[model samples]
Target: MAHRKVGFGLRGIGHAVVNGVGRLGYASRFFLMILIGSGASFRRIHLTIREIYFTGVMSLIIILVSGLFVGMVLGLQGYETLQKYGSESALGSLVALSLVRELGPVLAALLFASRAGSAITAEIGLMKATEQIAAMEMMAVDPISRVVAPRFWAGVTSMPLLAAMFSAVGVFGGYLVGVVFIGVDVGSFWSQMEAAVDFRQDIVNGVIKSVVFGIAVTAIALFEGYDAPPTAEGVSHATTRTVVTSALVVLGLDFILTVFMFRGV
Candidate 1:
């Protein structure tokens, strides 16, 4: 009995490993197909643009609102913490560094995943469930080019702009709290932030992070939707999975990228 139990456990582990590797391979193939089809999809720029409006424009309000509130909170927290050390004036550097280096990209991506990513997944999953994708395939229309690639590229393009907007709005929100409300010197607030936050080191790296996150989140959304079972329950599950998986991927990728981008610093 003991030997049988041990063998069963080992078999389960082996099966899990194989399943994980198979999923990875499948996702990789899907990604490659998107890349290859992107050129042809570009000619249908109008479709991509419509998707951008859906994915990017639709998410802007929430992103901006969240950014503003987050910045204000950071400013308040930074001021209170720095006051103990008589360094309240450094609030600008604190807020700027926090947002530009981490919050801007991570939070924006999270919001994007929850909003646009889930929508994309559900939309595609429903199409699959309704036999729309099958019809397209039968008509010799490449769904990868017609459906997936455009959405993927739109997301990739939208993320950096959204991150930039988030950072900009966050800075303004911080300024309102620190400089106007709390009486931190306005000049010092802006100047200190400018001095400490290098465009190349902080801003550029943040943009890079957002771009990577965009790709990961969008790719997962498309993959889940494409792989979902052909049923209403499957569409719902895929949508939920998109949000959960995208969030995890964004966070994990952020950690890996941060390690490489700011290793010594």
Candidate 2:
């Protein structure tokens, strides 16, 4: 009996492993199709532009407000901490470094995932559920080329701009609290920040992170939608999954990228 149980358990484990690999293979095929389809889909620039308007413009207000609040908090906390050491002039370095190096890209991606990622997943999932995707296929249209590619490309393009705006607004907010509210010297705030925050090291790296996160979050959103079961419940579940999965993937990628990008620093 014990031997039989062990054999059954081993078989179950192997079966699970094989199933996971099969799913991974299917996902890879789907991803490859999107990449190949994206080329000709560019001709549908109008559709991509519409998607950008939906994803980027619609989300701008929230991103702007969140950036400002976060910057203000950082300014207050940084000033309070540094004042104890009589290094209040370093407030600029602190805020800029925090925002550019880490907070800006990560927070923007998180907000994007919560806002636009969920919407994309829900939209695609609804199309799948309503048989719109199938209808396109029945008409000999490739759904990936016609539907998914444009949205994917739009998201990849929009993320950097959104992140840059978030960082810029956040810096201004920090300036308000640090310089005007707290009486920190304006010259030290700007000059110290300029001297310490390297465009290449901090700003460029943040942009790279935003780009990588954008690709990752958008890819996950599209995948979840495409793979959703053709049911209302499935569509809802995929939307939820997009947000949760995007968050995890962004944080994981941020850690990995940080280790590689700033290891020497």
TM per candidate comes to 0.97, 0.94
Minimal lDDT window, size 10, model 2? 39-48
lDDT of each: 0.95, 0.92
Q: Candidate 1, residues 33-147: lDDT per residue as tens digits?
A: 9999998658979999999999999999999999999999999999999999998879999999999999999999999999999999999999999999999999999999999
Off by more than 4 A, model 2: 1-16
- What local lDDT does model 2 show for residue 159? 88
Using TM-score as the measure, the top candidate is 1
For residue 43, give model 1's deviation from the true position in Å.
0.8
